[model samples]
Target: MLKVQEIREIIKLVDQSSINEFTYETNGTKVSMKKAAENVVVQSQPVVQVEKEVTAVQPTQATAQPVQQEVKETVEPTAKESTVNFDHEITSPMVGTFYAAPNPESDPYVSVGSKVNKDTVVCIVEAMKLFNEIEAEVSGKIVEILVENGELVEYGQPLFRVKTK
Candidate 1:
């Protein structure tokens, strides 16, 4: 697997070049990158066996190097108002792309402070071209969203923190 810094460098080079698509393969690791609108999209496929980890990094052209901090895993909200104490956490049942809203033009199904019931569809996880609606098993208010839109999420990872009252 390529280091985060290496990936950022590739993204920078691609953005500067006129070519629309760039592919890099080395040591059984293949990474394909493309530019869409103002966003740099990267996809990786590792043929070597390694620990399972899914990371979604959004590269911005403001600087030569993309900020590595943006590549993060599930993060718990640190703000006091968004903090939850042993509250219900909605986890991903399977690995897929996390979509907060049904479509790009529509509002998200749920956001911070949004009220939800057991059957409410909080988000959709798309795997293998199939969109799966992930429901909130416990009814409560959504305190925080752990993943960004279009980010790849892993199985059993926390997607949202629900504050059950």
Candidate 2:
């Protein structure tokens, strides 16, 4: 178990780092936290992935060109660079158990370094007897994963953060 001070420190660190997500495990206790968007969908099938429409939680869209330019130009000056601190958190649309891979022996849908687009199948969330494919709504690199494979996830729970240009 973690002490109250430790938990507070972790929260502070997450905010300061602009990390969007963080996870820690020690002595069998694990805690995952992420800054999530309310309407981000974390499941999509490959066939229908391109057509999936998500509710726009925020009525704003950041231009892709400038964001990319800033990232490239600032990367050399600072390690963090112009990497947008914003997080596009892919949350479970419904309750289910998260599966990193299609099956135990298969490769995972996405990993830390995976570059994903709106149609990328990030993971599967199995609910009841059906498996849902989680899609990324933006183009970016996965910066962090918030849930463990086979862990139970609730509706609107964050699964990963994509670092957009």
Candidate 3:
């Protein structure tokens, strides 16, 4: 049987590659995975016009003119880029529903500012009816929680950012 860590690595590799599906079988154990097709919705944004003064200079003459320009500004940071200062990241090993605790009635496994070690269980990702405990994987204080409880997480999605000792 393949170990959980090995399986996680395989899932990461498969998710990053162009292959849409993969299967492995050996010694009576089998693992199969398929990538879900994504639907992209494109929304049109209203165009903004900015009026600016421009100076045109030539060897013989110089002239000033008013020009109209369209400029779009965005300041959102992506998942990896947003956590640049963090020392470690706890990521989901498979696509599943993320659970902050073992059950709804229980307290969350970890919260912001919670201290944890490499072996500390931080959350659970339920895939195909099986609950897989996700560990801290690094000794650190939780700097941020990237996903809400019960959210659907994709494979290798960052769950927590940690500031390591």
Please name the candidate that would achieve the greatest TM-score relative to the true structure: 3
* Segments in model 3 whose C-alpha atoms lie over 4 Å from true places: 1-84
lDDT of 3 by residue, 15-128 (tens): 655546555444444466677774222222222334555554334336554444544554432223473468888999997778999999999999999999999999998776
Better of 1 and 2 by lDDT: 1
Question: Stretches of candidate 2 above 4 Å error?
Answer: 1-86
Candidate 2, residues 51-135: lDDT per residue as tens digits? 3333433334663333121111211111112343546888889766779999999999899879998899999987666889888
User: What value of lDDT does candidate 2 attain over all alpha carbons?
Assistant: 0.66
Models ranked on lDDT: 1, 3, 2
lDDT per model vs. reference: 0.77, 0.66, 0.72
TM-score of every candidate? 0.52, 0.49, 0.54
lDDT top scorer = 1
Worst 10 residues of 1 by lDDT: 71-80
Clashes of each: 0, 5, 0
**lDDT comparing candidate 3 with the true structure:** 0.72
Clashing pairs in 2: 42-134, 43-133, 43-134, 44-133, 44-134
